[model samples]
Target chain A: MRGVSLATPYLHIDLPQLRINVRRAADQAALVGVALRPHAKTHKSAEVARLQLAHGAVGLTVATVGEAEHFVRQGCRDVFIAFPVWVDEGRATRLRDLRDQADRLAIGVDSVESAGNAGRRLGHTGIEVLVEVDSGHHRTGVAPEQAGVVARAAQRAGLPVRGVFTFPGHGYGPGGSEAAAHDERTALETARDSIQQVGIEEPVLSGGSTPTLAASLTSRAATELRPGVYVFGDAQQWELGIFEPDDISLTVHATVVSHAGGRVVLDAGSKTLGADRAAYSSGYGRLLEHPEARIVTLSEHHAVVQMPGPRPALGSLVSVVPNHVCSAVNLADTFWVAEPGGLRAWPVGARGLHT
Target chain B: MRGVSLATPYLHIDLPQLRINVRRAADQAALVGVALRPHAKTHKSAEVARLQLAHGAVGLTVATVGEAEHFVRQGCRDVFIAFPVWVDEGRATRLRDLRDQADRLAIGVDSVESAGNAGRRLGHTGIEVLVEVDSGHHRTGVAPEQAGVVARAAQRAGLPVRGVFTFPGHGYGPGGSEAAAHDERTALETARDSIQQVGIEEPVLSGGSTPTLAASLTSRAATELRPGVYVFGDAQQWELGIFEPDDISLTVHATVVSHAGGRVVLDAGSKTLGADRAAYSSGYGRLLEHPEARIVTLSEHHAVVQMPGPRPALGSLVSVVPNHVCSAVNLADTFWVAEPGGLRAWPVGARGLHT
Candidate 1:
């Protein structure tokens, strides 16, 4: 509390809690006989990725070719770009550069167009292409039946097809992870059957979220798990029963700048907590200390909280639980990680490197 | 749009529109016989500050000591930090350094605590302190009656009492700026009279916002205007009728990544458009060309836009009108100014320098 100086608002990571979360995830993945490929996009820090690797993560998952390039530059060898990539002229060049640097580079291909593009971009490069199958989350990925067609297209284009992958994003709601993992098993199995029916052997089937990773291992269809936000549990994870409050690793450390009209405004705002409120989200996010306090609104530099109990005095430092950890990490330039005995700064290495 | 790849997800500033906005604000302030002190927090570009100065800005206003330092480094002569700064030991050192650099430096003081802190830190440096009066926006500042008390407190602490400044931020809503400006005038006049009754002549009375500037001029109580966001009018300003779409000087150039289910996802996401959304905001923001298309949601690197009509094809480029241009600027590493013939990159000189 004494060291709470008013600087730019930032997310603080409790290393003890983060290590526990990582161990729990690794243990769960091992129990299910699947490898954990923690998504580096969540933290985007080489330091956190190192922790995941130390905890038995086989590889790391990234969202973009730029992110893959960044992590690989930071000495990460195996990187999977989990998002369905559409390789245009500029992106194709960048993807080639990333593929050359990474030890094992795999990209998600959800459509014939993307498959063809990847095939064209990764000519003679031996880049692995994962058929993205929709397991419930309709944001991306092809239908389970269409996965084989996309896989065949990739194979025909001279790219090696690496089974299938699906994101159980639907598992993030109340009692949704188990059902989502069930859906993932069904989708991945169907896709695998379709690929075999075409005389192609699928090598990998990956699916998992923090909530679904435990349940997903019940199915032999999944060979690997890619859970990103699990490394830094957030308010949404806590609300969805994916994590306990003690399991929450990341929090926004902010000072109360003003307290009036039963509302307290903290120096942390959308720039730190991020704007990732779902319809079921209690509010903007949760407070670590005062769970009853709801973040009613967030401006650029102020998070307005309606205190259910006693208001924190002006200048009081409070920890905020962001609704989504990944987005929050992107908002910050760097994060302070309090490892057991020391504090260190980790640059959100790939933040805003969307290009 | 060939050869117009002005860098994806970067702010595109139209010099023509920006010059017009500056001239218009200056003409309005001149007509009202009030000096204009354009707040640099919106752009944070010294180049823009110079433009405002050339367009007749008497001085410049900033939100933080960091911004004041930045402006002073850019050779700005007069700078006023409009926020009530709580100076600690380290910041006190910075404040002293800033005082040495600037020809005229002033900071807002709304509480006795801050006044005492500033006085103690300043140590007879003769730093000018302006009492921040709460006209309506309850975010910060003291009540109108408390302005005199705070000024006297500053005087007692040996800090030079300059005058009163109030931001009619609440005036940003629908048909609210005019009423808010009226309230600002009444509050400042009452506070000035109170200070005068105590035999102290308040030197300056400042109040302004893009929405309230016109109304504020009707009241002669305010002698200076501080409008920041008008230089790059955003979707919020357009919706509030504060500025027309043509008056919008800045835009986010993003590429369409996916088009499916009557929705088009752009590469911009929250990192480019920013996560700032008011209750009255149409959606996250606006698409410059596709006005009917509403940005329904944003993840870290993907913006899901629900098209009102036909969806754009993938790989198509688009310009987004962010809800708040200031936040969008903060999210980017650099901005591109599209001049007559070519594009020039300007490092968001003060980005992530917030303290």
Candidate 2:
């Protein structure tokens, strides 16, 4: 992103790097012979989603109904809300609208009660259902053995059961990818068998996370993979040893606003860079210019960094890789991209779609 | 907010409580004989800023030029960018525009070099400067004794030195408010004397935080008080024992999406409620209804709560108090306010103005 030092505290996306990252993930999925359904929760941009589709993604996975609506409005035909949705009357209305807009719509469910409610509210919408398997993450999903219960519930409610899916969120830590991959395969296989007992054979077993995408390829149980954050590797990915620093496509462009000796303060802070420091993550963020520098303290609008060597002068521009790319992207309204011609802006279209 | 369960994960504001909170701070400032410049960084809403003005506020305080411009465009005459800004050419143009728009424009400066740079780029703008004094917080300010050095530098650069200010951010901790208040008074007094030594008498001494506002009233060194989060008491304020449960005016309206026994999950998480858990804060956030519940884990869009007793049924709406209200407010585009007649939507006017 040359000649892009015009502002501070703006999220900058290197277009060339972004394209390379997108293609690399698609190539990995292709090599493994898994159908890639890239999750849009990380970038949340129509431009990025279109790139994923162009690179041979089967569909898009989203975390919320609002996000599904956003991508559908942007002309994405096949969309899956990858969250265990609690469909109330309001969500039923919105999901019905999304069903009419998209060629294919799917949602995750972990319990019989919620599946029954979704079936009651949206039976005519013909939205496909995917039973969420815990897969050792134990977050908003049923145990692998209980997947058939929710699948039968969906089927009884006239909602067609498509497959089973899991997040494998445990993959995002130190020495976690290998074990998480093993757990994902075992859980998906068990869920598929349980679902098959209920007469749904050859179920689409979807499993993948950025940290365990390649490791998960060891098993052939997963027919589809949904990996977010692969489009823009972040500081956590670097610290977890899952990604090279060269793979980070997005960074916060900040200016050194204050400093005392080797202590530097950047204009970018929690408000811009996001405040998500995982237990295994090294720090709040990392400076691309000074790899040894540590962002010691982060408040609303100030990121304090301790540099080992000479610090940058006040007003000197720096790029920061956020610890969690998804949360950081959610904080922004626009993405500043370095195009071949010049700096351009793309809307973070689904940024605040909290519902 | 009554009859406002149309959606989940939306921020809800109790209009009556918000008014009460605003008037309470105004009354405290009046009784303390200090000019109250309510920081708009908390709400970032033009309607809330107007309410603060109606409660006898002197002006509005912001953290960025974009924020200052937002308030100014909303018809606020006087605004203070209460951050040690490092002005580059782009920021210089923006600050100059702000000076032309605002009736009274002031910014913070912490270093002589930045003061000179601002002077070079915006000398003729007639913008006032406040020398930032480092209280016990030590985040981003010069030492109390160095206040005069920066003040003199601002004067040399043709920028009018308007006085000194300190954040006292350390006040937001358990049993830390009292000592932080004492430190704030001492820092302001030492800074006032230091600025006086630089030939600026009757400098505007400003120091205050939500936790230290009442305690700092014991000292007469401060001529102005700035408290941002008092308008919407949050989990942090409650944990610090600075606010009563009744003082909380805002909450996230979420739904019980999933549950297994007492292990319930809400459809709100870090993306909506924010991920700002301080060392002294209890959990990721607090549920208004289930006060004893522990939010065990938080993901992008799921808050896992381990409740003690009988839990709310599936699809039941719940209220969640965010750890930090400012960050939560920033994550939303619209504020659902319970007006007397009905619910109303107020734009989070300055949302995502990162630059």
Candidate 3:
């Protein structure tokens, strides 16, 4: 009832809290002597990226060429596509266009095949290639020992070898950040030593997540940190103790559409909250105010909430913190940003352009 | 490799199959001697709704007031908000505005509280109200015996009571459609008899799902049928024997962005297929061509698909049939309709305008 003007069940970001989150991350990274290259994949907004840059982020990190292109159009000069670059004839053209706009473009290479593809496509564009090493997240990236071989292959293919990077995604589990960051430091150091053993001067050693960044401060192996979700801490981060409740910035503002027999239905459904409940999650997500209420089920337009006490009256407004902020941001076209009392709309300029 | 377009990974509906699906549902409803009020919440496309009307659908069924308003603005005359309507002072004004535009506006009421709320807010507008009975889908609605009490309450508040309606949502489970339809018949008959016993004539009795419509043909209690997801049969319906592989009208067209060690990564992530995997589901969804491949995990912009044999090369195209089409449609802003031999684009006018 606090002047809820959202098209019921839309995401709302408190700008005041978001700014504080960004500044905190920047301040922490600066104190640790690591360049904060905030991953724009979390917010996927040029406005948020500008804020991160304004708060002292050195550059931006993205997952796709499309995302890099979007931020480049918004005047971002340096970007690193952190995922392994698998180039075909079509994507190579897009990469060429991206290189023309940005001052520096760094791509990740995990295997010799991808290195050859990048080199063949890049020609003489002088694209900087980073050998992706498998830290603990076994999803992508190469083994540390193999990083030097891929880097040598990339150099042979006419691409400039930059350094090595890894994502400590396994750090998200309960009490795993410290161990995972330790593993990250070992992987980065091993990969860097391998590259150096091959006599290639690798400069950037990048690694970090919201969970592992704090633990990464004592390590000298990583020179740059890329933490995306820290700017808008989510339910998972809160549960992992990576963030406190007050650190959460973005929330989905929903209206109570139905109430019957201790059950409340919110207008925000899977479309707003997203359906990314991790295996460790107790429920779909957590409600901000109604902590006792559990989001039992979600359809396309209706979120069935199970309340512990009497049901909320119809038309009551509530805020939901999603299990994963990245997926939630991808579901909406735009989100509202408020500075405590003054809320302004920020279009998610690159919400669904997921190429 | 097929000519893979560089579009983002997500769901894409084949226009030709969509047309065939629309015609089949309309034809089946006509044969059953019941009006086909095709639910537009599945596709959420005004163009699809127009095709449904052209194919003999009498009206449209929407899950939200925002959806109903979207269709009405696109020239739909009769619309029914099939979900339980809960009115407060603020929503009452919007409901009145909706009543002013359409030839007939109908809402569902499942409880005495909702009936009172509707009556207090909508009495002057003369909007028709339908009592929602349980009919074995225990998600929402009231018991059949309670229909009379709700109807009497509506009448006392000076609101017009139309009839009764129920959704056989249990039909979605394995071999549950036949039993669910039988339950639907009993509930509709009981509600109708109870309403008439109260000295008021019940004009309508509506119930149906794609799986139960054939079984419901023998029931004279139901005056109309509302089936939405049949327009775009999904993997769930395919497994339930409700639709053949050929009957699947929508598919997510995705490009292989990465291939390594017999693993392929798709561009279509949870944002496209949606995170609606039922407990019985093997994976996030099913691939139409590569049936052996399983979508093991989905990040925001990437889907890790594990193939049984050697992986498809990067840039290869694949089509996937999502488990639930409704949530997939909600994630997209617009969809391309590729006719059998022609091409056209249709805006999903009500993609994210959920209130």
A1-355: candidate 3 lDDT, tens digit per residue:
2653545667788777898999988887788788999999889999999999998888899988888899999999999998876676667888898898889998988788888888988957967889888897766778887888988898889988889999988897898999999999999999998888767774689998889988887675699999999989988987888888787999988877665434677777777788777777767778888777788877666677887776777767888888899878987787887765566778888777666
Question: How do the residues B226-245 of candidate 1 rate in per-residue lDDT, one tens digit apiece?
Answer: 99899999999988898888
Which regions in candidate 1 have their CA more than 4 angstroms from the true location?
A: A1-8, A217-221, A260-263, A308-310, A339-342, B1-7, B218-221
What is the lDDT of every predicted structure here?
0.80, 0.89, 0.82
DockQ agreement of candidate 1 with the native complex = 0.36
Who wins the lDDT comparison? 2
Using Cα atoms with residue i matched to residue i, what is each candidate's TM-score against the true structure? Answer: 0.93, 0.98, 0.93
DockQ scores of the candidates: 0.36, 0.64, 0.45
The C-alpha RMSD of each candidate to the native structure, in angstroms, is: 2.8, 1.6, 2.7
TM-score ranking of the models: 2, 3, 1
Candidate 2 Cα errors over 4 Å, as ranges:
A1-5, B1-5, B260-262
Which candidate leads the pack in DockQ? 2
B204, model 2: CA deviation in Å?
A: 0.5
Ranking by DockQ: 2, 3, 1
Q: Per-residue CA lDDT of candidate 3, range B218-294, in tens?
A: 56458888988888988888778888878887888887766643467777777777877776667887788887877
Residue-level lDDT for A252 in candidate 1: 85
For candidate 2, the TM-score is: 0.98
